[model samples]
Target: MPHTLRLTVTALVGLVVLAVVGAQAVSVEPAATPSTVVRTSETTRLPAPDAPNVVVFLTDDMRKDDLGYLPHVRNLLMKRGMTFTEAQSPHPLCCPARAALLSGQYAQNNGVHHNSGAYGGWESFDPSSTIATWAEDAGYATAIHGKHLNHFDADAPADPGWTNFDILLEPATDFENFTFFDGDSFNDDYVTTRLDERTVADIDTWAGRRPFMIFANHVAPHIWFPESAKGDGDGDRGGRLPPAEAAYAHALKGITPRAFKDPAFNEADMRDKESIVSGRPKLAPRPLKRLNLARIRSLLSVDEAVAHTVAALERAGELEETYIVLTSDNGYALGEHRFTGKDRLSDEILDVPLVIRGPGIPAGTRSARTVSLIDLTATLAQLMSLTPTMTIDGEHFVPTLRDPEAVGLRDTMLIQTGAKDPSARFPGWAYRGVLTQRYSYARRINNGPTAGFLYDRRQDPHELANLLSDERYRAVRRELERRYRVLADCSGTACNRDFGPLPRPRPAR
Candidate 1:
């Protein structure tokens, strides 16, 4: 059967199944309101005077430096809000990172360690304890418009916490011919434009009601391959620019990051690094650069979407009260270290850009605090003065929002790949690590291999030098390994405690 025909049949069957199951699904009750909630030891602030609105603009496969290409994001968000310089995606994979953001737990606790059809996905994620449900219980209007989880279909009912849900029903590949479940029926349209339109309409409708939490997820900048280009050797599928933004392609043709195809690109060894990283195919530098430019051009549409959404909020009289956050599900590696995509433990894939602008957040501020996507759930819960029923692996970073100079909340961030799920694209290649202010340490898991890595981030930001075998740094490696072992299995509030203080931020050169 044709792909479209299969999808149509699946969607029809799913709709019928959901119609019967939806009525039997239990509704989540709102948790008891707390008068005074203690978030952390150093920071204790009052809840908002009224529930503040939140709008998270989540882009797919966006890197930290890619924000430079987005003017509206810089002016509206970076200039007006706090920019977290050290923000990272805990797991650095699509489904795992998204699940961590919503559940406020690490991949181990959330049970979504990889994308759908591989180990875990929507079926493994526990939707009953998400930020949307908590916000709904707090008497705030909630809606999520755009990409939800990988492989999500009509069989999956809308999250009970959301008053409105418009989610993508197919794999996020084609930019123009994607289908969406708009809380009632599945419709095909241009993905980004449709999402922006739905977001603006929702803001207008909910502006008069209680505070709203809107997640505007965009599908720009992700790789798309035309049917004709999929099996060709031209490599066009990995960097095809969207047709709507063809005009902007020339704007970033010559612009490339300094680290593009740097010294670490495709080192010739596998004994030191994990099989997934060291075994990647090598590509020419020029083609990788071209692909990077194409990726940047695709992001122009996302910038336009951000501007329109902000304008909609302002026109609806909720601009000042709204908290606008811009970030990505995971960072992409464009020919960095000879790797073209994510699923590795490199900084290029783990470090994401996080900007938050809201009522109390200071303007034109920058923070060096080490934070993760998991912390978003706790931050929103505390901001709205609602207590969550489940134990979360994240801590509220409101203190940093109130004070940019505030000390970092977490001493070390636990990073890992998917578990030993044979369904994964790279099965049995799992690894776990810990990232501190100055070092990164990772080792293979499930007895796959004895490969391990240790990088002194302070001296080698690009992670070119591996110090795991160096006798001079043996003590440092041991300490990092000890921390990683303890953190890889941690859960609940124990994962949020400060293991140690992060190094002070260095001034920009």
Candidate 2:
């Protein structure tokens, strides 16, 4: 037995040496500037003959199971490619997640660190040097449709010339009010219908000859939408539910989702409500329900829009060539943790669905590997065989797409936020978590002097249980805490307080 143990240790040591040597041999050279990390090898760069056209369909505030995917959406994806089981939005908000997705950077690295009001907006970014520009430079026509929550500077022109075409479906890119605020909202059916028409026209004109990138964003399953508040007596002017959604919502007959059927609400959520009402002087809670109903009702139209968009691609003979990505900007907090919207760091807000289908990507496979939204930039650039304009926070998920058993892919992900008073000592919170098949460990750093959360995802997927003090998970907690610090350093968001001992989250009484 002793001899066997010695042999095992020797084998492990030899493997470690080999791994170190391999890393040293294959790792790309570091960049001259500290902020940049460039890949120097040709293998790390995009290869020429395999580039494919890209189309990203971004949606707003949609849940994982909201789509008819899995046996349904899964069937569609398989017929057309890749679906990620553990895809995540960088931050659980409209602006920050979108900014990260577009810039291929985290909230801190990108100027738009938080949702609106927290860090001003994305106009602080250089409009000319976005991911769209990089794709455009690579000989792809770029265009955007649907809601534009990433906009910051209202005075700035609607189109920043990033694309050959710009189609604003409404007055503002975001549809928090559900009103079109421009021409007739229904004249072109739903927003999805408009996007479908425009995309089809572009494809027909181009005749599938030129590679193109279209960011077809949709606003559905979000607040102040068609189903959020239907019967509540509020002065909301957002009466813009499409016919299908109106029918579904009408069928609901005042039955809210299982999450919001309760009369009692979370304390924190109520406090937030009071603060918003005091600050903004919005309508009462009853009216808010009506708005929520409206938002919910609008989803059917969006879903149908997705179906039509896919059909349009098929009609254009570009179905196999075009890579379709169905994703949400972020998840919504229907009622979990007493939160009604995104912006707060909760699982419902951060965990988003990412379904992809195209050539070179496998179909009907689901991987549990945690992935970030910004990774889309690198992945798309790789698919097109074009050099990324800048190194991004997102890693290439090509390995996961090609083989479910890819090596060296991440088993953990770090979620950070800069939405804090920079003047404070421990201003922001940083979450470092290791997600295994059954468990997820999320440790909070610098969250209001002392705050953190831990979840046993296997049992409490909703995150109702905060097992920070459950001594049984001591080893797991310690390991996750260490990983958090190491990742924070690697990501360059490491703060002095990040190394501090993590506090156990208190349970709700």
Instruction: Give the whole-model CA lDDT for all candidates, comma-separated.
Output: 0.70, 0.53
Q: What lDDT would candidate 1 get against the real structure?
A: 0.70
Q: Which regions of candidate 2 fall more than 4 Å away from where they truly are?
A: 1-50, 69-75, 78-80, 118-120, 152-161, 165-190, 225-296, 405-408, 420-422, 426-449, 470-475, 492-509
What is the per-residue lDDT of model 1 for residues 1-509, given as tens digits with 9 covering 90 to 100?
A: 23453344335333432343221111111112211211111112333458899999988788888886676676668888999988888888777888989888988788887775445677778888788777777777777777786657676677667777667766445666666664323234455666777777777777866688888888767776433335221122344654444435355436655455456666544445555466666667786676676676677667767766676777678988888999998887776667777767888888898999998999989999888888867887788777777888887899989999987556888988785468544452377889888988888675543476888888888787777777667667777777887887799766755666433333335
| Candidate 2 lowest-lDDT run of ten | 23-32
User: Residue 477 of model 1: what lDDT?
Assistant: 72
User: Per-prediction TM-score, please?
Assistant: 0.82, 0.70
Compose the digit string of candidate 2's lDDT tens values, residues 76-185: 56334666667788666776788778877766566665543445355545455566767666666666655665432334454443443343432333343223212234
TM-score of 1: 0.82
After TM-score superposition, what is the CA distance of residue 188 in candidate 2 from its true location, in Å? 10
